[model samples]
Every structure is written in C-alpha cells, then in structure tokens.
Target: MSVLSALGSINWIAVLLAVVAYSALGGVWFAVLFAKPYAASLGRESLPQPAQPALFFGGPAVATLFVVITTATLMAALNIDAAADAVVFALVVGVGYLAANTVIIAINPNMPRPLFYGLISGAYHLVGIVVTALIVVAF
Candidate 1:
C-alpha cells in the first residue's frame, strides 16, 4: 500500500497512546531514572535548568509523536497486524535506525561522554519503539 493509504488506515488512537507512552518513558528515563548519569554524560555537575524549558520538553514530545506516527504508518504499509511481527519489525527499526542514529548524533564535538550518552539514549529509543509497536498492533 502507498504511504498515504497506510496513513489513512492507521489506528489513530493507538498512535496517540504510543506517543504518550514513548514520551513518558523519556521523561522518566532522563529525569528520574538516569538523571545523574545523563548529567555526567554531558559533563555537568547536575541537570541544568534550560533557559528555554519549552524547547527542551516540547521538542522531544513532538519528535516522539512523529516517531510513533512513522512506525504506525510502516506497520500498516507492511501489513504487520500480528503483535509478534510488529515487535520484530520494531526491533529492526529500533536498532538499525534509532539506536545507530542516536549513537552517531551523540558522537559530536560538544558531547563529553558520547558513548555513554549514546548507550542511554539509544536504549531508550529501542524500548520506546517496542512499546509503540505493541500499542500499534494491539489496535
């Protein structure tokens, strides 16, 4: 099916749930679970209060929505109706695209501990994708 048709056929409720779950995971992962480690990865004594907190939080929310939407669209296009198939496909995309790109993006001049940061962030995406896949396929 074409991308447009796939988009139309997508379960929007599933997409919304996935986005909320994925974004909430990020909030907990960074803000609660690994706050210290994440700060260390950035070479900060502690998590700094961003001047533009809206961008800090809102950017990821928007990105999470896009990620969930894209994953749902792909699942629809590929006819991944089964939860198992959705999981497998999610793993593939999570590791191949999200994790790899996270690592690459982390390895930048400003990042003090790029590898560590990559591991934390990439793992988040990996799990987020799986959670999203399950929701998308469930509906």
Candidate 2:
C-alpha cells in the first residue's frame, strides 16, 4: 500500500546487487581509469577524495541509498512485475541522471571536459541499468 511497503515486497537482494554493481563500476572509472587525468586537467594534484566514515563507507553507501530510493519509488508507481520491465525502468532513470549531470556540468564551466565527463558519467548509469536489469531477471 505505501510505496515503501510495495518496494519491500520486491527482492531486496536483487536491488542491493544492482547497487553494488553500479557503485563498483563508478569506483573503477573515477579511481583507476580517469582519476589522475581528470585531476590534472582540473589543475589539481588529485581527485577530491570522498568523505569517509559516513554510511556504508560513504560514497557507495550514499549511491546505494539513492538507487534504492529511486528504484523503490519507481516500482511502486509503475507496478513493475517482470525483470524486463525493470530494465526499461532503469534505462528511463538513467536518462534522468544523464540530464541532471549534463545540467550540472553546463552550469559549472570549471568542470572536466564535457565529452569526457559525459562519457564517464553515462557509463555509470549504463552500469546501473544493466545490473538492475540483470537483478530483475535473475531474482
């Protein structure tokens, strides 16, 4: 009946797996792949380290909470019953994320190169969509 209740009825394991997968994807991109180059481009010695000792170790925990809340709200509203449906839902959410990030980059001219930032950011959501889809299908 409530949105949280509707979401609670779904498989939490699947949701968590999707969140972890997406977070890992982002970590790899920001930490290993582009960290140095992006930081150099920004005229900084290093990428801004995330604030630690928060929830779920910090970044990943916050990211997981975001995904959970958004996905739960979506499932409640859309009444998703199948994995394929969840995939579509994730893709739609990805677009919203893309738009938001794009707007942020536009508003902040000092951000990284638009193309590079967009590509990396887009990959993050792509991971989220794929993982969410897989979770929905498998579980």
TM per model? 0.94, 0.66
Best by lDDT: 1
Query: What's every prediction's RMSD, in angstroms?
Result: 1.4, 3.9
Predicted candidate 2 versus true structure: per-residue lDDT over 21-107, tens digit per residue: 767766776679877754554546454655556554567657665766567656765677677787777777767674456446734
Off by over 4 Å in 1: 46-52
**Native-referenced Cα lDDT, model 1:** 0.92
Off by over 4 Å in 2: 1-4, 33-57, 102-106
Clash list (residue pairs), candidate 1:
none
Local lDDT at 104 for model 2:
63
Q: Name the weakest run of 10 consecutive residues (lDDT summed) in model 1.
A: 45-54
